[model samples]
Target: MSELINNRQERIEVMKNLIRQLHEGRDEEKVRRQLESVLQEADYSDVFLMEIQLMEEGISRESITKLCDVHTKVLKKHLDLTETPDAVPGHPLHTFLQENQALLQRTAHIRKKIAELEKVSEEESADVLMKIRFLLNELMDVDKHYRRKENLLFPFFEKNNLHGPSTVMWTKHDETRSYLKSVIQALNEAENISQKEMIAFARLAIEPAIESVEEMIYKEEKILFPTAMDLLTEQDWYDIYLQSPEIGFCLYYPEFEWVPEGGLVENVEKIKASDDKIHLPTGSFTLEQLINIFKTLPVDLTFVDAEDTVRYFSPGKDRIFDRSRTILGRKVQYCHPPKSVNIVNQIIKDFKEGKQDVARFWINFGGRFIYISYYAIRNDQGTYLGTLEVTQDLTDLRALEGERRLLQYDEE
Candidate 1:
């Protein structure tokens, strides 16, 4: 007992010294090696707090990136101790990573080609602009990666009371998104860019976006992931694994199967079956059926198609705005208040003209505030049907929180 106590005390001292060094920005490489060695031998719970302390002390991004690979190796080794097989190819997470890998590669290729084209004379710049436009369209896939984390992973982390790191990471994600959008806008408007201008844009816009993604991976592997591994059960991970494919990944490829720990393989099939249905009070329905049901909802929905026409609308419950049957055949402008008619017409015209797709307005009425938004509805073919007008009451829906696991019946 005395020997074990002494050993524990020694490990504590080592952790404190390493953290001090990292905080002081002294010998980061040596300190990182020592930290990794400590992690390999210690219980995760013992080192977890110290690791967070180091992170709080401003560890270098380069150090974080290097440690990410180390953490992956450690996780793989630990996971391999279990008898479960690896996750299959085209598994949700796997597919996400695969898709994002292609996007990242394409973005890099486009950047390189644009750089080469910059060296040519002014007459050849048009070809470069065309290439940049193509790349911008491809780079829009960044939204997929952001949505996956925000929609899927963040919820799980929030449930575990790990909000601090999650919030920081989310803020970083937004910053990266803003940078990408700025670059895309600049690239679109740029008629002639010299080599220096292109290089500056690449540094300011493209590289930062990539670095942000890479840094996120670092945080995930070292902090968010380990916390998740500790807090979430195998079932939780399986659920995430199942849903991940929908949102996809960013520059990732998985080499292992993700068979849920201690669960039967058939469980994956069951999850897939249930995932295909939308559960409602009355009954479950297929995806297409659910979409149609939402369209037929009690409130009226008017969609400005990609072509900036009134293409589709749904009737759903408790609609805040009035949608008359006569408005169905008319231009979206005629449906609005005359005072705001010009703005509506302008929004529609711009959407059809590919200038803008979203317009929003809100107002207080009948002792309650209402929020209304118009989203340009476009299909995969880039065909604009019209704008979707969604208007909802802000009173009751804004108060939702916690889990609603039980059923409540309401009689008409």
Candidate 2:
């Protein structure tokens, strides 16, 4: 009950105890009151460290995610955002902030539409629902926002040995994605539905989706960004800034350019040092040529080494599946959803045992026919090396009537 606030360790312990009380079914208001009385202000890092410590103490990540919002609400009042570090106009955090602002505007518009739908007559309800649906479609751009954070930002935190917060947030992102998908499906099926029924569905499904998105915004601004700003070095942020364009932005584009005062020192040096040509048994190419070749390839290629870790992925302009450099050292199984992880593991298992050389599947995704294939790579001695996953959009190819014998270039 008595702890020194100035001591970082003591603060972490106090915060962790308060969070455990919330998780153990204790009265939230009472615990919050205790928190307010004991801790004058909630430091962003303390909140994350508390979660990490709680996990170390045997609490599951799922439990932490479920209670994430509750504890965040409790700590929200005491957070001093004004003290959070400032990010310059072109910094990655600055861009993220800009994107969040744009997303907030979209969410505000959707909320207004929902409010209008509640008061509109049955005849007018359909129009209101249509507008809301359109807004939801626009709101789906948040996926890119989440992906940027997941793939670009989370890696730095993991490198610092701070994995708990990112893990919990990723689970929340998936939950939000699922809710958005379900609500969109419900809206598509509400053709003949009555105003009352539509409003009920909105409350049951749509509102939660918006709420989840807003909750993440709060978590990022108040907890995640401030913590990251403190933890990540100047060089680390510069690296993220360089790779950000590859994954793209969400709802906003940064107009300002930011280069570190000393410029890209180590990165440029590394590039110069690695500019030599690489020779293979059959052919050879410079590192730059090889990189561009991969980018120009028609298929999206991913290589998972024999250890099941993602070693490389091609970043073609029109990729069939989204991938980021964060996936480089991540396990392949973590790349898929929980339900499909078993299938992924089985494929890897069969490939390792020499039972299969190739596996293929095709699915219709958002009206596009997608073909995915996995092949086992081996050496001359038949030693297993890795799995190569190739994905392609086959919609146009599937619809081709006849092959053209004449050379032709497709118009842009």
List, residue by residue over 382-409, the lDDT tens digit for candidate 2. Answer: 9999999999999988888967999999
**Residue 393 CA displacement from its true place in model 1, Å:** 40
Off by over 4 Å in 1: 1-48, 51-86, 118-121, 218-231, 241-412
lDDT (0 to 1) per candidate: 0.59, 0.83
| Whole-model lDDT, model 2 | 0.83
Assess candidate 1 and give its lDDT.
0.59
TM-score of 1: 0.50
Over the stretch 37-109, how does candidate 1's per-residue lDDT look in tens digits?
A: 7655554333444444445556643454344334434334432333322235744444454645566676677
Top-scoring candidate (TM-score): 2
